[model samples]
Target chain A: MRAAGKRFAGGRSHGDSRVDQFIEQIITGLSIGSILLLVAMGLSIIYGSMGIINLAHGEFVMLGAYTAWLLQSHFGLGLLASLVPIFIVVAAVGWIIERYVLSLLNNRPLDTILATWGVGIMLQQSVRLMVGSELRYVQMPPSLSDSTDVLGFSVSSYRVFLFFVAIALFAVTWLLMNRTTVGMKLRAIMQDRSVAASFGINAKRVYALTFAYGAGLAGLAGALVSPLKSVSPDMGTGYVVDAFMVVVLGGVQSLAGTVASAFFLGELSGAIAFLQNDTVAKAIVLLAIVVLIRFRPEGLFATRVRT
Target chain B: MSISRRTLMRNAAALGAFAGTGFPHIWIKNADLARAAAGEIKVGVLFSLTGTTAIIEESLNKATILAIEEINAAGGIKGSKIVPIVEDPASDPATFSEKARKLVVGDKCVSVFGSYTSASRKAVLPVFERQNNLYWYPTLYEGRECSKNVVYTGAVPNQQQDEFVPWLIKKFGKKFYLIGSNYIYPKEENNYCKKLLAKYGGEVVAEEYVPLGHSEFSSVINKIRSTQPNVIFSTVVGDSVVALHRQYRAAGLDPEKMPMASLTTSENEVAAMGGEAAAGHFTSAPYFQVHKSPENEKFVAAYRKRWGADKVTHFVSEACYFQTYLFKQAVEKLAASDITPPNIRDAVKGQETVAPQGRVRIEPENLHTWLWPKIAQAKSNGQFEILVEAKEWLKPLPYAAYPGQVCTEKGLVEKS
Candidate 1:
């Protein structure tokens, strides 16, 4: 009887270890999913408020990186300090692009996509021509570079900080969208442009603000990621494709859906990558997503219809 | 205000007669000669200026421009000015074929120097063959392809893997792990290495191929650690190389303990990987920045003067520059009435020159150059310090040194 009891105890411990590993993997997945969420939020906001896909959205992120690089290279600012000015500068550029180029094609989404694609090409080539196409490094703040022991796992402080930052940004974005008058106006414009104009909401002004805000978010994401990844002309290409996938997999107009889908895909990809080759893992994830879309039509977290 | 056709013709005739009479005879004669030579000596430069490989292409273009400028300053090739026409392949194979046709049929270039990817090279091969124009490909690629119309100036497997594998075995003894980006170059090269490793009594621990441009590599690194092989034979390229090396370091695997001997990691990739990340890694190539020679010194100095001091990569852009010189030397050797395509091809195959490396000869059978291979270790500053060199130039054997099944399946050989 004592031997059987000891055997039961051993089995319980093994089960506990498996549960702990599963939790750890979930945490890692959520951390990565948060980063993807931040990037996709920027993309979704721009696409939602203004019909422009902004193919140069990724380059705006690149600009943010370069801005941070320039700040450190020139002014000797720390990572956090440099991020502030990068946000401002990149936001200003976004405003200018919106006011000058994107506004010209208000109802023309296809033309806007093409124009922004051209803009992306020009931006990448200009960076290459000016900086000579070499990878530049951004200094990680020493505090964040170190790791902290959490539940017997060595989790990077930088990664934890990134999670908190993303959550904070998400909360702020939610407040801005739900509570503010500008947010209401922007949402109204998105729902029905003609009706919003009838209700005396300056759709143009709302678009400019939304564009700037979207770009600012992208800038922030770029500043956050520069430390993790090297800065180059082509640094953002990989993320752009994944961001598109996230936005589509989620509904194009649903922010909550975007977050949930990003997390879902991120966890799916991360877990599969752990088991199989990354390529095969991605293929499986994509296939699963396609199957889900065929069955569900909306998404995993489609909003309930009030009707 | 409307003039009749007869009146317009008469006025035009009078003006033409007056201008013809007033123009200098020397000027007129020079204009006529220029018109006669308007069919210029055309050379095409196909490079990826817009896509993922643009970084390498930019350096290659700068090197090519430097070569063209120097050649033009020396009164041009064969007394006719070398006209360079450039096209961007955008790193797309289909686009490469289209651009190659544009260069051959539309621009009518005599020879093309380009292609950084094996896919792009394969796409343009039929175009070059059909047009019967010369292509001086300047990037190290999969080594099974040999053609009369293509002068592959880059390193072959024998020049790189044959020497590197044997030397690594001598230093680190018979255990290996192969890691590479999932592409033709890595797949083909790793397969060849497997054959060679087996022949040499070496055991290949594990072979893992990740997708191209894959960023996250913890699992791959974990596999490497679990396998615990003596050395990693790597063929990853571009941004993935950066991610792999950085993750490898973060995972606490010291290259000093278990070194990675890579085929594709050059000084440029080292720079991308950062100095700290790339330090102590070993890479094998036919060229290095720290190669000791007066000619190399001169070439380095001139290159620095032309394109700032900070730009340096140890692959074969300098060799591309040397290829232009080789082409010029061949043209000078022929000294034909007109520098036509057939004559230029014959001249290139027959002529020999003392290159920056040493005396190089183009094998008439395959149209590839025979040159020495240099092994280099990645230094702290993203440059290579030459470690060992084949003192004599190894002949370009596009086929395996020994006749075997692998070589035969690929249809690569020197036909006597």
Candidate 2:
């Protein structure tokens, strides 16, 4: 293991005050976990509730990122201000894909994967052709641009905001899925689509809304992430893989599971990366997840409800 | 809007050279090559126009085309207009090989200029070597090979690091934190850097590599935070460059006291990260658009006039522009029929050009060029401020780190 905490008088830190690198690693892991939660929340929702392996979920993220870039560049809209509109715009695209494409191949989960993957490629190319492949940047809100001091170590306030936002989004999503009427209908459909349809529920409408919501969440993730990462067509591909891993390890249909798994993966990756290099940390994380999945097939927080 | 205006202007410029299938334009590059098949000399232009590498390679394509157009306008090489048969390899090595075959065997092109990554170069090397054709690679890369069929116009390891290490050590303190993307290129670069540090009596505080496309830098930043290295030698590339810079800034780490000296960060990356995030970092490169010279000014003006004012000319594009001239200078001696790979190769030895970077010439000893290496600091306007430029051209030593290993007119050999 790397040495724990050697004090160095550099950048904000100086003189006698010392912060444990171990504590800083925990914060780093939490930051990483929050990022994972931010990106994978949408994937968790769509895949968990709908049983749709949304390969185009990432494209939706890309689309939102492009939307964010366009808004900022064209209209001088800040990222925070543009979030709702970005969500709406990406949600509409998601609605169209579900209504026109996914609705047709409803019961066939495998074909949805192929079709969504194709859709993702189409979206990426469409953006590339229209926008051109130059790197576009998004500016962060002025307030969160500075770092916040936590236990003598500096953490980006934007990242701290992201952690809160992830929890907030998770809370909102969980409440929406449990306490609301839309949530009731969605759960009814998830339990038995035919029975839900037979009863007074508009199964088609609910599915479309759920998909749109999922896509919007992805859009929000992308919009938030745009400032940190360069906005390009292929940017979402990286997040999509990690999002998939989070969703799978979280137990596909469970929101709580998604949150838990995102945290688990993020902390694991962050702590290991601090000790070892990032590459080995990645391999180790993947290996750990594989072993976890092999033993606990239902994953971390699988819903126990049979019906 | 700035986007539409630039797009409209670029669309008009793209009108002549290559036809594109509508937006996210997968270019049908060979359509117009047939028009010049009769009078113009055929030269293949292989660059990835779409996919991940397109962000950089697209400029290279434009540079090559601009040079070709300039040559034709300036009465061409021996009055024979050069026509480029452009092909998009889509940033895949296998596709690069396939395109190379089609360009050399199918189109009967005299030469091809292409590739940014080493893998793509390696892929296309066999096709060029087997067919006895020439390939001009313009990207600075990890140098270990000496292909007789390829002419490297970019800086090798020594040309980039030899001056960079000592200058950084003298200016910034010597406790260096070596970080890069997990790849052979960064590893090779760090090896050379370590060698230089050892010679300079510098201390290495830490070494690390993150995966490509990685955007998280908090853990890495935490390490940098506590370790308090005097300098951060970074080769973390692609999307990671943007994240690392922004996060470093966000983490309140000042680049002034502990600056990031990079081989990977460039004008393109600065654009991606935005000037505020990128400013104060240093990059060791052979060329920067901010470099003042008559040749560079003219070149930039022409490039902007053709492409768009919004577009920035970078080191690779500069090399691409001059390497085309280097090709023209070599091919001027040959009769149109005498334009085989071997004859052109022999003629290209020591061919000189006053590039945007500075005076550059192909080394007769090796197929690589002698470059004027410079270190530049990123300013707040998405541009570089050229700081320290070499007094003279640094000879490209492909195997400078490995001492005895050298490339000559024949091939790679050990001289110790």
Candidate 3:
């Protein structure tokens, strides 16, 4: 019994102050919000340009996590080394899904939603059948495994890394959508597909690329978050719900809106959870989203368009 | 009732198949009954082969199969092979009861083994009771009731926390922060923990719950950090265990300083969260894979050989494996021809066996097993190092938390 206490370090408290607690909670919430943004950014992009609700977006994230786990576990690839490979692999999967399965359901919005959902379940079940339903873990990058002191409060350096990644992804996405030639073509298609097609934009190719990019972003989110959570076949569902919440609460087609709402909801839930508890926090946050949705059906940051 | 020619011919083929098993030509009225005596003894193996709980339950299913396979290889309880009719309840309570009904009524299994979650057990309870069939439940759970129709092979809260809490308080300090998945097992176990804590004059800094499958823990970790309790009494179950442990590590909260004393984390869970993720954390259970004994060594070796080298056997799977041997031992007492549910149930009442954990026996008084209690610190290799173990088997007390309630051989006995 005494031997059990061999590893027992003497106690020392950190971040006991109320101000410190507040600051820590804010950072924690931002970290969570950043994850939501990462997952939702691709969803918003796909929806904004294609008007295709890729319900399999979450599965893309799950696949990315699985890819990271696979690469690291089989090939001895570190988490950092596997990120590009994970993104590419998952994005390729997303590309095939879009070109082969989703493209057939194009004109039918309801069918596209249902088909993508079917694709999601198929992806989940295939993973379950192939890998088994056991929880899989991804190795954390050794460099960022420890906590860093911030404003006298300790915060996970990995989470801080994820936040920066989310910001960087958002910037890249912003540049791609606003400045790139692909962005011009995608915008033309979003505005009027026939006109874009008539203007030789090759609307279908552009749509597929946008879809693939969105999926790549979601996959990256999954890879980054994998170290913090267990990777399982159904891990995507928990994240997808929050991602949808972020996308819906943000204007459906707005990347900036997704970033704003993800943090807003995250901080709201985080602060509430600190004040009360998780159950109450979730209930209140969901209630707030519902009430907000009733007043503004187009969402908080609906893009103003002159018709 | 008149038998059609088609049914008669099918019965003839089945009878012929049974005859090939080398049994003497006994006058049997029903072909199905002869199938039990001469050919096979069918039992139900109900488990969640798919769904949320599959991560843990799948191993339990494998353990059950491994035990059954071993039994069959050793001539199978007086020459009749034990055939398992396995079904996946998919971790749903309604499906558990539904499949339990089908396994008992439709498949005509002599006895059934299943259920992990308390909700599924409760759901499955009524079907077994109504059918008067035996159900073997092999998962540690919150104890509050004793049913005549079921045999419990896992530890209850009393068997788990009775020794654990005091040891934690003595080793650490009085202040404990309680957290768990929002479910009955955790809630009930925490009730027992609180009761014990209060009796021991320990202080509860805070208590909280996360929803099932909830993976985020930064907020909860923040609370733990601010409170700075000597111990975190965690009952958090399922995949969320991995998340909580990983996040706890990432948050720079040293388990060595304020260790998570878990009632739910076992070797299988530790396997999911790498050893480093929860290295210094503690778990209180009736069994761990690293339990040393000839019986345990053989069981672990055989289990790994049958499954994979990397596959782990935890408290639940150990119970699941030994309980099958218990079932076989009970079934062997009665003649193969007379192996009915009631007979099996009666025979299983006082059965004792050497489990991977150690020597264990079912308490005839309550139908719950007498189990060894141990606290273990997780090693970085995903194996647990035993810290403290009870000198002898702890008695099962399903209704101990409730003063007026007690479970006897007959059933629940209440006092005003």
Residue pair clashes in candidate 3: none
The better candidate by DockQ, 1 or 2, is 2
For B1-416, candidate 1 gives per-residue lDDT tens digits of: 12344764776588578856752223211222221155346788898887887767767877787788888888886566777888888778888888888777676677888888888899999998888888888787777776657887887777788788988888887889888888888988887788789888889988777888787665565456445678899998877888777656644467887888998887777766667778888998877877777877777787889998877745768668778888777767654444655566778874576656666777666667777787888887878888888888877665653344232222354454
What is candidate 1's CAPRI-style docking category based on DockQ? incorrect
TM-score per model (chain B): 0.86, 0.90, 0.91
RMSD (CA, Å), candidate 2 to true, equals 7.7
Q: Which residue runs does candidate 1 get wrong by more than 4 Å?
A: A1-28, A48-52, A74-78, A107-115, A129-134, A139-161, A179-181, A184-202, A304-307, B1-40, B169-175, B350-354, B405-416
lDDT of each: 0.75, 0.87, 0.86
Write model 3 residue lDDT over B1-416, tens digit each, in one string.
13344765776587568756653324322334442655689899999988888888899899999999999999988887999989999898988987888788777788999988999999999999998999999999999978999999999999999999999999999999999999888889998899999999899999899889888888898788667799999999998899999999998888887999998899888877888997999999999988899998898899999988988889999999999999989988987678889888999988999998889998998899999999999999999999998999999999868989999987899989
Q: Which stretches of candidate 2 lie over 4 Å from their true place?
A: A1-19, A304-307, B1-37
lDDT of 3 by residue, A205-284 (tens): 88778878889888988888899998888888888888888888988778778889999988998888888888888889
TM-score of each: 0.84, 0.93, 0.93
Lowest summed lDDT window (length 10), candidate 2 chain B: B19-28
Q: Give the per-residue lDDT of model 2 (tens digit) for A1-307.
A: 1122223324343433334666677788888898899899999888888888799988888888899999999999999999999999999999999999999997356668668988999999999999898888899888999987666556789989999999999999989999999999999888888899899899899999999999999999999988877888888888899999998898877888888889889899998888787888999999998999889877877865323
Best DockQ among the predictions, by candidate number: 2
Q: What's the residue-level lDDT of B29 in candidate 2?
A: 44
Ranking the candidates on DockQ from highest down gives 2, 3, 1
